[model samples]
Target: MKTSLAVASATVALAVLFPFAAAEAQQAKPQSWPGIKRTDLQRHDLSAPGREVIQVHVDFAPGAAVPAHSHPGEEIVYAIEGAMEYQVEGQSPVTLKSGDVLFIPAGAIHSVKNAGSGNAAELATYIVEKGKPLLVGK
Candidate 1:
């Protein structure tokens, strides 16, 4: 009877601790977005579900242009090198030089075109909302 009681107590303790062990197992380790390169444009997913963020780098060749697209979250661009033209929905295209920043509202259609005859590069950070599309149109 004493051995039976001991076995029951150990079983109860294990059941209580099982959930914590499972939770610890469920925790995700830190990871970097693969395929990030400095010489070329790249898109990287930073987090999951409750923390979704996409990082896009634009390395434009001479006179390169990105077609109009809509973002699910508010998107912003920081021009790192060269000049480019920005066009947003209901707004005229504006010339943006290096070191300039632009704010794009959520669901706004926009495009980026390199203005200069040389290469233009930009580092962009996007705050993506859950279930929101990153690109609206082709």
Candidate 2:
């Protein structure tokens, strides 16, 4: 009888603890923004200490936008196709077409949108500090 009672007590404890554990696991996952698809193309450590470079291919559906965000370091963007409008803090918004490029200074809050009728894409190369998140939403 005592063995059965201990098993029941343990089961009840687990039942009470499981939800909290599940919630913590969910919160530990990284946050993903909607309307944008990002594909990591490459990552390499830079010669400079604690610095790294990351290349990503980003695609935006028509009328889609990435909300204001900032990076740990510089961002060099090359528009691959369609039109994209970029708004950088302290600067006027600019629209870039295919083959156009833009530079964003580190920690400069900015956002981008697909301004064309169709999908737009860009190759984003980031020079950032190692072990830090690529983007921080504003």
Candidate 3:
């Protein structure tokens, strides 16, 4: 298990447990969702425009990374090749290999490092709240 947070609403039963729990669950699901290639993601159903959602295919050359950044929305990264070390603000990093997943909550400061010896890649599906931008450069 990993540290997480969730948005909650009174109408949502799970929200009753803890407001943050609901947000965590909602944001966390994307990290574990099935993934496809960048081309495939282009053909998949995407959230409405202006709603702030994006599917990104991140390819790395041995040790490349997307760089450190923060976002207004929750993000999920699914490893498509090799392995990756993921770290969030104030937490120990975790490593994941092909088919592995990582969940990052909204506004969580995080970074990704490619740990594989060869070429590596990851598919990131970013889910953000309405009207929020998907990715912010560090």
Candidate 4:
């Protein structure tokens, strides 16, 4: 009877703690958006103090959009396929085609949309502060 009670107590404890654990796990990773796929290509520590570089390949389904967000540092985006429109805060939206590049200043609020009828993709390179969330939604 004592062994069963102990097991029941442990189970209750786990049940109580599980949600907090899950929430922490979600915060540890970057936020995700529907219809957007992000693949981490590489990550390396930069020479600058407390800085790191992260390269990601992002694919957007037709007419998909990412909500306004900002990074801790600068982002260099290279459009790889199809067309994408980028809207940077306080600036006119710009569309980029294949092989085009755009530089986004650090902490600049921005959003992206797949402007073409087909899927669009871009390679994003970020120079950001280490140990901080790569993307912060505005």
Q: Tens digit of lDDT per residue, candidate 3, span 25-98?
A: 34434333233122214223345664455676876667666556688677888888888888888899898899
TM-score head-to-head 1 vs 4, winner: 4
Residue pairs with backbone overlap in model 2: none
Clashing pairs in 4: none
Off by over 4 Å in 2: 1-32
Off by over 4 Å in 4: 1-25, 28-32
How much is 104 displaced in model 4, in angstroms?
A: 0.4
**Residues 64-133, model 2: lDDT tens digits:** 8888888899999999999999999999999999999999999999989999999999999999988776
Error of 1 at 138 (Å): 5.9
What is the number of backbone collisions in each predicted candidate, taken in the order shown? 0, 0, 6, 0
Ranking by TM-score: 4, 2, 1, 3
Candidate 1 lDDT, 1-138, residue by residue in tens: 999999999899779866744442233110121221232133345556543565667677776676677777777788888888999979988888888999898788897778888888788777777544455663
Error of 1 at 96 (Å): 1.3
| lDDT of candidates 1 onward, in order | 0.67, 0.85, 0.64, 0.87
In the predicted model 1, the residue pairs found to clash are none
Every model: Cα RMSD to truth: 15.0, 11.7, 14.5, 9.4
